[model samples]
Target: MSTPYRFPDYQVAGDADTTVFLLHGAYGSKDYFREEIQTLVRAGLRVVAWDAPGYGISPLPPEGLSIERLAETAACLIDREGSKTNIVLGHSMGGIITPAVYAARPDKVHGIVISATAGSFSQKSAQDQETFLAERVEPLRAGNTFRDTAGAVIDSMFAPTSRGPMVDLVREVALSTPADTFCAAITAITRYQGEPNMRNVKVPALLLAGEFDQVGRPQSMQSVQQQFMPHADFVCLPDAAHYAFAEQHALFNEQVLRFIRERVLAQA
Candidate 1:
C-alpha cells in the first residue's frame, strides 16, 4: 500500500472551479511559489503550493527514493483538496513530478505548465551530479551548511543576470532543508528517468523555457516538444534563467496566465 505523507502546505487564493497546484524544485518549499500564488490569486484563481516529500516540511519517505513516489504524494494531496478543475505548474525538479501526477490521476489536471525544467537530464548531467555530491552530502549531514557545499548546484541553476536573486532564494531554502533530506532528493534525481512520451500527454501543456536556463537547455526542451508534444504551446522568456519566474516575474505571469486563460480557464 502507498504510504500517506503530509508536506509543507500553503494557500494563495480561490474557490472550487479555478484552482492551481504549484510544485517547487528540489531544496525548495511552498514559499518558492509565493509570487506566482499571489499573482494568480489576484487574478481570481485559487492556488495551492506544497513541498515535496523529503523537502521543506514534508517527511522523507522510507529508504527508497524516486520521483514516482513524490508524484504519488502529490496525487494524495490533490485528492484531499477536492479541486474540480485545476492547472498544475512545476519548476525545475518540480517539472519532473508534473507528468507523474498526470499519469497517476489523469482526470484531475486540466493543464500543465513546465518551466525551466526538462523531462529528464542527460548522461553528462548524471555524471556531474554524482561527482559533485560524492563527499558533500556527508559534510552536509555533519552540520556543514548546504549553501557552502552546494555552490555548484546554485551556480548552474541560474544565468549570470539572474544569479543574484536565485542565489539568495536557494540559499534560504537550502539552509532550511535537513541535510539528509537534501541527500535523498538528489539521489532521487540521479536515478529518475522522466516521462519519455511527451506526445502521450493528452492535456494542453505550456512549455515555458528560460532563454539562458542551463539546467534545461532550450534544445532539449525543443526536442521534447518536436518529438512528443508537436501541438503544445511554447514560449521563451528572454533575459531569464532557470528560475524564470523569479527573474522575469511580469512576463512569466503574463505568459502563464494567458495560456491558462485561453486554454483551461475558458473551458470552465
Candidate 2:
C-alpha cells in the first residue's frame, strides 16, 4: 500500500456551531484567507482554512499532487474537525476539489460552496488546455521562479477596476507557492475530470462566480450549474474577477453567510 499523505497545516477560529472550511485556489494558501476567516468568525461561524498539500507549512504528500489525493486529504481533515454542520468552501482550484471531497465522504460534508471554478478542467478545448499548461510550466522550466511569473498571472485574475491591498495580498500568496508544487498543481488540474463528481453532489451547493473572471468565466459556471447542479444557487459578483472573495469580499461574505443561514443551517 502507498504511504498516507501528510495532513495539512490549518487555522481554526470561532466557536459557533456551524463550520466553514476555506480552501484556497492554486495561487493561494491558508494565509490568503485570513481576512475572510476573521469575517466568518465575527459573523458567529467557525472557520477552518487549510494550506493545501505542498503549500504554506504543509508537507508535500508523498504521492505528489493529484485532485483525488487532495480530496482524500480534505475529507480526512473535515472528519478531524467535526462540527454541528460542516460547509466546505473552495475557491478556484480548490473549487475543483470540493466536489470530490463530497464524493469521497459525503457524510462529512453538509454543504459546498464552489467559487470561481467549473465542474471540470476538461471543459476547456484541447488546445486551450494545452496552452494553459504551457504558459505556466514553460516559464518555470526556463528557470523563472513563481515570484517572476506570479505578478502577471495574478494581475490577469483581477478585473481591470480592481486595485489596492487585496491585489497585493493575492500576489503575495501566489509568490509563496514553491515552483515544483505549482507545476504539480497545474498538471493535476489540467488532468482533472470533476463533472461526474459534481453531478453526483446531492447536498446543498452555492456557486459563486466573478462577473469578469476570465479563468472561471461566469458563463461557464452557469452552464455547469444548469447541467450538473441545477439545484444550486448561482450568483455573479459584479466587477469582480477570479478572486471574487477578495476583490468584492463584502458581497462574497454576505452571500456565503446567507447561503449558510438559508440553505444549510436553516434546513437543519
> Which digits, one per residue and each the tens of the lDDT, describe model 1 over residues 66-181?
77777777877777774668777888777877877777778888888888777765422666456546644766767767767677666566667775554576557645666667
Query: Where's the lowest-lDDT run of ten residues in candidate 2?
Result: 1-10
Best by lDDT: 2
Q: What is the C-alpha RMSD of each candidate to the true structure, in Å?
A: 3.0, 1.6
TM-score of each: 0.86, 0.96
Clashing pairs in 1: 13-46
With candidate 1 superimposed using the best TM-score fit, by how many Å does residue 144's alpha carbon deviate from the native?
5.3
CA lDDT of 36 in candidate 1?
A: 71
Model 2, 1-268: lDDT tens digits are: 1122688889989997789998998886988887888899999999989999999988776556989889888888888996989999999999999999899878879999999998589876677677667767888898887788776777888998887787678778877888878888898898888999999999999999999997888998999999999999999999999998888989999999999999998878
**lDDT of candidate 2 at residue 76, scale 0 to 100:** 87
